[model samples]
Structure formats: structure tokens, C-alpha cells
Target: MTRISRILDADSYKASHFLQYPPGTEFVSSYIESRGGAFAQSLFFGLQIYLKDVLTQPITRADIDEAEEMLLAHGEPFNRAGWDHVLNAHGGHMPVRIEAVREGSVLPTGNALVQIVNTDPRVPWIVSYLETALLRAVWYPTTVATRSWHLKKIIDAAWSETSDAPQERLVFALHDFGARGASSSESASIGGLAHLVNFRGTDTLAALATARRVYHEPMAGFSIPAAEHSTITSWGREREADAYANMLRNFGGPGKVVAVVSDSYDVYRATAEIWGESLASQVRAMGGTLVVRPDSGDPRTTPVEIVGILAEKFGVRTNSKGFRVLPDCVRVIQGDGVDEDSIAAILDNLRAKGFAADNIAFGMGGALLQKLDRDTLKFAMKTNAIRVDGEWIDVFKQPIDDPGKASKKGRLALVLRDGAPRTIRAEERHEGEENLLGEVFVDGRLTRDERLEDIRRRSWR
Candidate 1:
């Protein structure tokens, strides 16, 4: 694959957007928030991606001209002097800096994930002007992380309600099947790692590359050997049993787990007749686990029904919750219709039908990575405080038309009080340096590089 060089990356209006910022504004402190939408806004993600993709990445004079031309074409005001400043900088590096809570740390409802400021006094507009780009950068990862965190809570609750070994199986509960479904390779890399923050299973291969290139990790996530419909059905309908046998023969054995999509034609027939009856003895003797995946039918009930059938054919043991579970040799993974709402419904029905949550896992595609937006979590970046003249003035926006649009006031710091995250005015909360936000990127340098393992630990907790 050929890598494109000197890509023009800023939003078309980004230059003009900063024009309204007050002149002589020596300091600008803004924040990124989730606005308590759909979830508690646990994960603060994507800063690492932002630093690599935007700040540290080189910009050339030609790239700046391309952006200037784009602004010209769109009939929006463009700041020529600003673009010239960037072009003349060493390697055309971005002049602003980013400070924020460590990526992957969880915060409260209105906690700030990021704070921006201009490192050079002459370029005060640098930070405020980049709001469009910064907001766009963080929202996707934060939304993806938030949704995955909620799903993790659901999975954890289900396991706690059913499994005796909740922690042992928690990380393997949900796998990322969202790579091809993502909007772009960049989205796949960001959102896939966001999902991996909560769970260890994934089919998003580029996420591993993101972790390696951006986060500097040996390996961030891994996946099991799995088969899609094409891999299974290519054996021919008459040779369906051969396909099943070949899966077990190749990927299954002692101490291994492999997933096979079993809903190519008749999911029920495949599970009951072919997998349960025909391959039951072989599966038992294989010394590994066969994860049967059902890709069609109503996702809410099909998993429960499949678990029931598997329990009947493969034998069952009652869990501590008194729900029946198939032998450890056989399990089911549902990879279709797996968003938060549908997933909750499926688990509720599964538990009601006397199947332990451990009997089934999940793999989510488009919904997990691509089907969300800024409003999905009500994300926004607002200028909270700015310095005008020699005095610092607190700033905010309170729209009478929509009171819900009111933003936070004053410069902010995320600190720990009584062992819990508390958002306090940076002026008043000048105690110990327990502020959760850290300076991750300064000017053109990467300051606080984080390992993906550390990020996963912070996010999971």
C-alpha cells in the first residue's frame, strides 16, 4: 500500500472559526465533554490519535495552500497570516499544545477530557481556532469508548448474575467485528482500540497497528481463529458437516477456541443436527471449545434458543444462579443485531430462559464503531476561560433558546477529592497536583506517551 504524503488535514472552517476569538487573548482554556448522554461518560479516548494524526504529522506549504484554497472555494473567511505562520514553522508543525486527563481514564458526567492552549504567546488563537478539529477528533473515540463501557457494564452485570467466574470470562465476552463496517481505516483504528479498552477480543486487525505505531505497544489486542459464512459454506451444502469437522480439526484441539458461523442455511438445524448430534462426541474429545455463531434470525431469542438446544444435546450443569449452561466444550457467539439495546434484550431473554450469560458471547459490527456521532453522546468543546489584556476572564455560552446548551464556566481542573473524581475551578482547587488532566502534547513534541496496556487497565477499571 502506498502512503499518501503531505495530506491537508484541517477542517475547511477551522481557520475562520478562530477569527472571532478576542484579540490579545493570551490564554485560551477549553474543554471536551460528553454531556452525560446515554452513559456516564467513563472513557476519555482519542488524544493519542489526535497527536499522531494532527500535531506531530508534518504539514507543508502546499498542504497549507490546499487548505487555504478549500476555504476560498467554500466562501468562508480564511486566515492567510495564520496559514503562513504554520508554513514557516519548523517542518510546518502545529503551534498549539494539548493537556487532558490521561487517555482511557474514566471521568464523571461533566468531567473534561481535554484542555487546549497556545504555546506561543503570539499565536493565542492557535488553540481556540483548532476547536473544530479537536472536537471532531475526540468525540468519536469518546463516544465509542462510552458505548463500549456501557456494554461492558451490561456484560458484567449479566455475568455477576449468572457466572461463578465472572472475571475469568469478562474480557472475552465481546469481540470487535466492526473493521469492515467502519467509515474509514482511521475510524476502524480509533474505534476498534476504543472497544478493546473494555474487552480483549477483536477482529479489527488495524487496531493492533494503531497501538503499535501510535501508542508504542508490542501488542494491544488479539483475536481467536474464526470463520465467516464464506469460509464455512464454501465446502458445499452437502459437505456442511465436513466444514464443521474441518473447523474443529484445524483450529480446535486442546486449549484452543475457534468461532464458526453456523447460520449459513439452517442455524437451528446446524446446531441441533450437525453440531450437537453429529459432532458432539468429536467436540467432547477435542479438548477445546467450539464457539458456534448464529448470524441470522431474531438476535434477541435465537441465542437463548441455541443455548437451550446446545444444553440439551451436549448436556448441562446448573450454575450458582440455577440457570443451565452447556458443557464448557460448546458455547455460542451472537454477532448480528448487537447494539446496546438489542444486546440488553438478548441477555434479559437469555437469563429469563434459564441460560447462563456464559453460554453466549457477542460480536458487534457497524454499531460498535461507525453508527455513532457527536450527538450520540452530546459531545462539544467550549471556551471556558480566556485571558483578555492582563486579566483572566471566565467565559461561557448560555442560550436562552435552549437552556440545555449552556456550557461550563471558568477554567477547570479535574481533581480527586475523597478518592473520587471532582471537577473544580482551577483557581479554587489549587491544592495538591492531583489533577487528572496531564499535558500529553506540547507544541510539536509528544510529551506523555501511553502504552495501550496502561490505557486498557485505566479504562477497564
Candidate 2:
């Protein structure tokens, strides 16, 4: 049994969720009743198989009855004749053998990792409707999850030096713009959450909420103080200063303020002069620290200079335990256009200037998520080859020499080989197969219901 099954008993599992259906039952029935024929027979067979597990449950009966009553009361026309015929059709008439590796496994592009076999010759037409969407739903999440895992490695490495300070070390924040109606918002949200197991910083509110609900990230990316007032007039209002003050007044201090973006007008002058005294004093007085953010210009020079100024003028006072006051006094966050190389440079510069590594937070946006070369990550699907016209023709994309879009074909099995998981193609038919995709739902019931935390833990692993 999968980990998902251990928590929920068998009976409780199957009564919750519904699986995807091709063309959907309502459409299928309408088409068949309005224009009755062999197409109707196919629709009938599909619905029966689709609802086999559903009709067995009392809950489903109640729902169906309720829906029927509503429809009848409203005089809504539904083809009950076509619906009942399809509902009562032969269960084994159209068999679609779907074979896929476990959903979380990493896959390559143009690979026939998933195979859908239409047992009945007449059901081939339905493949076009389901194939594309199904493949994408599975493939993109896995890809994003894999990418997030890779990012975890980088963050883990960078934060290693501050192991003594567990809270200070290893912060993971994700800003998934892909959720704002991106072509693959669902994939992006799932994939983004899979990788954001550590730290907290993101603009995607829904993704953040999901991550917290499912993953339990400590700090949330609430609001970043912007210097909007700096550009209010021709001279631009000292928006950065005003914004910081407003935040301080409302939030009571910078304890909850993770980071503040200060460079809306002039980064250098702002760091040295503007709000430096007043803001820093407020944060320090309140027993909180200010994280000054520079969203533009050369980070290599900006953070180094800002840290230097804060330390020089702030009086290097030691606490009761004798830790340097300035190092913990404030932190510098660099955002705009930051990449791995640029981040590395900023870190190196800070270290050389006696700035604590943990005192610098990297606010990575497009560079971390969007700028990655899609070519580096391979994701694809393929259909299983079946006997056609008495010829053993392999229906698969031939492997390409290109590293980015290589394809793996044939009826494959993913097994743990030599203690590490690997994929193996089945040479011939075998009985009692261990299907990677199990019956998540049976008879209109959910076989497994997992908490968001559980899913996040699985993704982290």
C-alpha cells in the first residue's frame, strides 16, 4: 500500500472524489440520443466503465437523484434514453490500457513514458480528446517538482555556513508568476509548491496559501515595503521613506518585516542618507532588524557599500554576549535581475567586506524560475506499440541525439535497480503487473485522501 493508504481505511477512501472522463457523460449521452448510432454505443461503454465504481455507492445515488429532481423540476431536457443505454452498456467493450510510471518520477522529453491502449478498434477516436490534457497534467508537475529539487540543492549549499543558526540558514521562497493565468497555472502552482519547502517569500498569494496549508512554511511573503512615493512627482515623493514609515506605524516595527526594498529612486544615496537613521533607529529600538533591499543597479557595489555605511555610522556596539552589533543590526536583500552568477558575486563581495553571509537575503524572481532553460529539463510521453495490419510496427518517436529532446520508447517498467530507482522496458507480456498509477478512486469514491502537509513532505523527498 502507498503511504497515502496508511492513513485512510479502505471503505472511507472510495467515497470522496471523481476521476476525469472523456467527452464527459452528459455530452456523450446528448450526442448519442440526438444523433443515435455506433457513436452512441462507444459513449455508453465509456460511461459504464467510468461510473462502475461510482454507481455502487449510496452517496452517488443520492447525488444523481438530487440532480435528476432538479433537472425535472426545471423542465430541463436530458436524453435519459441515451444516458441509460450507455449506463447499462457492456463494461468490457472498450478497454483503454493506461500504463505510466509513478507520477513523481523524473521523465525525459519525447519519451513514451505513458502508454494508452484502446482495446476496441472503434475507441481510437476518443484518444485525441483525452491524450493531450492528461499527458500535460502529469508531465508538467513532475518536471517543476524536479526543478524545485534542484533549486533546493543550490539553497542548501549557500546556507550551509550558518548551520549554528538554524532559522537563519536555508531559506526557500518561491514567486510563481505562472499562476496569474499562465498557460500552465495548475502545473506551475503544484510544481512551485513542491520546491518551496524552506524559507518564505512569494507574491503568488494562492501558491503561498497552498504551501502553508500543505507544506507548513514558517514565514509568509506578506508585503514588501516599496519606495513608490519616491516617484510620485517629477522629483518623485520620498516614497521609499514614507512607505517604510507607514509600514513601521502599522506593523509596529520590523519584527514581522522580513525585507524592505529601498532603491526606487537613488539606491546609493538612499542607502547612505535617506531613512537610514530614522528607519534603522525604529527597528533597533523595537528589538527587530531591518532588511534593506536594493532592487536595481549593480548589487556587487550596492550591498557592500550599504553594509559598510550602516556599520561605520551605527557605532560597532557589542551585545551582552559580545556578538558584533552591526552584523546583526540589519540585512541587505538584492532582488532585480539576480541570477546564480550575480548572487555568487554579491555573496563573495559581502564576505570580503566583513558582512555576515546570513545577513544577506537573495530575492530571486524570474531569474530562478522563469530564466531556466526548458531545454535542460526533458518531459515527454509516448503510446505503446500494438499489432497493426499484421505488422510489428513500433509506434514511437525515434531517439534524438539532442540532449534536450531525447525520447525513450516501448512498454517500460520503473523498478528500484541496485538500490536506486531506474526504468526498464518490458520485453514481453507478463501477468499480475504492478501498475505505477493505481486506482486512486474506485466506484466514485476516493481510495486515498492526503493532507497538504503529507503531499508537501512527499514533494520535499
Question: Which candidate leads the pack in lDDT?
Answer: 1
Model 2: residues >4 Å from true position, as ranges? 1-129, 167-169, 172-199, 208-243, 299-301, 313-329, 352-354, 368-376, 387-394, 399-406, 427-451, 459-461
Q: Model 2: per-residue lDDT, tens digit, 1-461?
A: 12211111122212221123223221110000101111111000011112232222332233334444555565553323322332344231223344443333333323333445443433333233333344444434444445455454444554453223364344433333334433444434544554443334555565565554533444334445433334322344545566666655655453555455666667666666654565667666655556677766776677767777767656554433333336454666666666556666766675565554455666655544444432334333444343444333344445466444333444455444455434455553245645343233332343433343444444435
What is the TM-score (0 to 1) of candidate 2?
0.62
lDDT of 1 by residue, 264-305 (tens): 999999999999899989999999999999998999888888
lDDT of 2: 0.43
In candidate 1 the C-alpha lDDT for residue 239 amounts to 93
Off by over 4 Å in 1: 1-8, 17-19, 87-91
Q: List the pairs of residues colliding in candidate 1.
A: none
Write down the RMSD of all candidates, one decimal each: 2.3, 12.5
Candidate 1 RMSD computed on C-alpha atoms after optimal superposition onto the true structure = 2.3
Q: All models: lDDT?
A: 0.82, 0.43
Task: Return the TM-score for each candidate structure.
Answer: 0.93, 0.62
Show how many residue pairs clash in every candidate, following the order shown: 0, 17
Model 1 residue 11 distance off true place after TM-score fit, in angstroms: 3.8
